[model samples]
Target: MNTTMNEVYVILSTYNGERFLSEQLESILAQQSVSIRLYIRDDGSSDGTRAILASFAQSHAHIDVEYGDNIGVINSFFALLRKVPPDAEFVAFADQDDIWLPDKLIRAVDRLKDASKPVMYCSCYKAVDENGDFLWQSLPPEKEISFKNAIVQNITTGCTVVMNGSLLTALKIHQVNTKNLIMHDWWVYLVAVCFGQVIYDREPSMLYRQHGGNVVGAKNGFALWLGRIKRFFLYRKKNSRIAQAREFLERYKSDLSTEDSYLISAFLAYRQAGLLKRIRYAIEMPLYMQKKSDNLILKLQLILNSVH
Candidate 1:
């Protein structure tokens, strides 16, 4: 592939990330084999993040900064996605503090270059500490990547995600409800599986920094598992996976295939079904997370109608 012909617009949303922001920006700038235009939106940082971004934007013609109010991460990313130029051939999301590998953009572009329809490419990551020391590498998804799995679990890490022009165009067609989303990347994965294709690469693409300020860190051990258990028991109704799926169905019901439409409708119906029906749905639905243990928890959540 001619790397010069592939222009990738990377959208990054930052909040109080001044400490490692410069390093992240430099790594992105040093990406090999592709033309990159970095677009950043600072989510009302009280630190030196704005000044740092301003300095970089002033020095680099390809870097653009938007000093915006604090709209949270999901909305901030969605805002940046909306601002992506229509002529852009590819789009990728970036984190404020993670050091992207030199081959990140090129790898994504290579995977998506042949796609003529809506398609997204995402990969695993090597988790690192605040000082960029290796922690652990995230495991690739063991099960199939499909709408059923996406409805229940998100395997796509936002920083490793890249979308073709067709996928971006499909996403822009809908007025997305950021309030109903769990994460921008999760929603994108769901959409890609439902309406297009998702390519999952097992290779590590970046250094996923895990620190005190991480909104969502890499899942690797017992602590994360315990936290997930707690969250499952205390899950809120308005922001649960069911709510996200409901919002997705409402927006794209007419465009969904018959099987997909029924799957979502049945998933939603579990919230109001009786004990027997809920149990039956739990046993019958093909929804699953990546791990068997997590799949068990998901089934329990379904049987108890705890997803809502």
Candidate 2:
């Protein structure tokens, strides 16, 4: 463990993650990149999570663990960010249940060597059970990562990210709205996209595990199949969820930029709005101005044809 190369801190926030905490910790600790540090914050886990962490920290000199009240996940993460040592050159977020590939940090550091960017993320591949194996791969792929697609897809997986310390220094975590914003990753990505560069390695670097305890995961294949049997109902239901997300973004419009504002506006107005709303806004917003050109054309055609 040479202290010479730029140090990377792995920030992990745990809350009742006892079932998989050890595996996640080991996966990071086993990285070939020795210029690394592990920082774990226990969010008042009632489970044996804290005890397990204490046991592991005793042997792993580079691993540091802290305890705090049962604050929400976002707060726990921001609190971890606040504690990052000033000398740590890189910071990565870790989920308590995922397994990082041995070369993840090594490759990430290697990629960032000549990069002018402040943050980098890798593509994610799913590791799911038979119940929901096919959901993620079924979604359409963006040709590349950019501010435009990022607004919709948010391709950067929280656990796959590594942020440069320069970016962290510029971050004001406490000022962010912890209530409406779902997770720390979303805010981190938003900031990176807003003020710095975000690069990605188009490869999956971690086994993004799915279980009942996960906040979000793939839908059962059986359910997807059953939905196809009732296509109309399924379509409406999916549309409703997209509608809800857009509504949330709209309510937070004042918090975002015009460029970002329009992206979500089009995501709702052109790409996702109810037929009538789509038609009305399409005629109102300029064709070239909307980022999703294909969707815009479709909506404009619908507007001309008087489709409601």
Candidate 3:
């Protein structure tokens, strides 16, 4: 079989997103990659989200909509994952409120095709308001990201990733059976870094929307930015978020023997609460460490690297 020209599946999950649904769909359907199929799973939205989906499905033969049992967003996406065709060469995730670039699929697929990597992800242009105003950006280099590193810092933007069939294989093998694994992107990234190759394009391809109703609104203004900086150093000092991430990493690390140890080391460092352990771990990887790295050498190196 000629797998090179196989179909691409954009598995999109939606809820009550009537306001931005059409725009998102338009952006996706307008992509230059025309051999794409939409596998949409709507989570029993009471708003006009279903209507918008119906309209798009009626007008586009490539679009197929599936009704989910109101099982919330994560489950709705998982439902689409289960229903994805066996012949899908590539799979990309889509949110209900983002505007994709015209060449999003083309660029991602081309990168994945040309490189030795099996997965491709890009950065996002965080659009906050009607003017497409700038919010912050997430353009962390892909080389610095991995399954272990993800536990310390989430560099993989969910909506900007394009993965291959290997992700589906990992999901089936890992059999992730968590009731609270609410973040699908993190899980998928984990699978990619663990069992497959992931290539990240530094270019931004999606217009990430931020609004009042979002689960976690984009941090805006100086005060919020400063607050985020403050919390970056202080949050793990007392909160359980770090512990939770570490636990997830530990649960899945056994599956990544083929990958490098960079991610695992980072995760272990974050899990350790002792200053001595953290310091020792930080010294070994002076150029890169997790949020909790507080060693003097690491700190000095970071300053020197940025002093120019």
Candidate 4:
């Protein structure tokens, strides 16, 4: 059991985030329990973001900042992950705009303090407007979180994630094409659920600030259902989410249980399956989304060859 609470290194990937970088940093600086260190990687921001990071790093011994070319968010996050110190006990992801609660680290650590296996804790977050006014609490549905669910969907939000050393070690020693990843957070969630443990917190640990510039935000009921269905068909072939699953399998196929390997391989090759095989995969595979409606949609995608 992990009896000791260890140092938490917060990894923040910043692009053109001059608008809310300081506030995010300040909120991180206020974390409780474990000692905190801030690691910022700038992805070629052509704005005042670098200057702000430099100024903050100058006065804060705990903050370390580095600048690199624009490699997109997924690669940028992996690049930041590579720079983490080998001895770091825990790792958390930070967005450029989210404001974390003061007890975020402590709350996550409390749940993970006794884990012996690779574990990650992710929490719900509050959705706020651009100016930080509260909009609504973004809670996850009380769905079964498992490798099957993770195979087709991501329930973990990166901004609220905290991973133990074992998971980070597994990621560090792995070789996978980060370019094929749909999102770094989703990939990590899949990995954790597949090979380790995942603790989902129902409470908000951070404020997810949505604005005109963000690509994803909180939606409810029918709108959220429709969006999920739309995305199911939106991505296809090798550029699909299932394609990312194929990548995940190739990277760690040797480590996967035989059943898991079979499951993922069927998902990878489902595009090539005949009508009979497609029906078999649709019925046999345990892949699912959090909501029953979305899970039904996933089954339809499998049967209709829409999950390519």
lDDT of each structure? 0.89, 0.65, 0.65, 0.84
How far does residue 235 in candidate 2 sit from its true spot (Å)? 15
* Local accuracy of candidate 1 as per-residue lDDT tens digits, 1-308: 64345789999999999999999999999999899889999999999999999999999999989999999999999999999987678999999889999999999999899888889999999999989999998888898899989888888889899999998888888898888888999999988988899998898999999898998877667978877877787656447788899999999999999999998898888898999998998888888888888888888988877774
In model 3, what is the error at residue 114, expressed in angstroms? 4.9
lDDT of 4 by residue, 65-139 (tens): 989998888888898889897766789999998899999999988887787778999999998988999988977
State the local distance difference test value for candidate 4. 0.84
* Pick by lDDT: 3 or 4, better one: 4
Model 2: lDDT equals 0.65
Query: Candidate 1: misplaced stretches above 4 Å?
Result: 1-3, 235-238
Candidate number with greatest TM-score: 1
Candidate 3 structure quality by residue, lDDT tens digits, 1-308: 65444467999988898988899999998888547889999988889999999999999999999876688666777788888866466788888888898988888777665444345465655555744576666545534666555443445677887876655655655445445363677667656665566677767787788886664444546856575556544442332333445545556667556444455555345333355555455455533433443234234422333100
- Tens-digit per-residue lDDT, 1-308, candidate 2: 74566578899889898888788888888888547788889988999999999999998898899998888777888888888976567888898887788988877777666655456555455564424343343232345445554443344678888887666764643254455454567567656765567766666676777787875444446864564345333233222323433544644456567877776566555554566876576666432221354345444554554221
TM-score of each: 0.97, 0.71, 0.75, 0.93
Model 1 has an lDDT value of 0.89
Q: Candidate 3 — which pairs collide? A: 148-263
Task: Give the least accurate 10-residue stretch of model 3, judged by summed lDDT.
Answer: 299-308
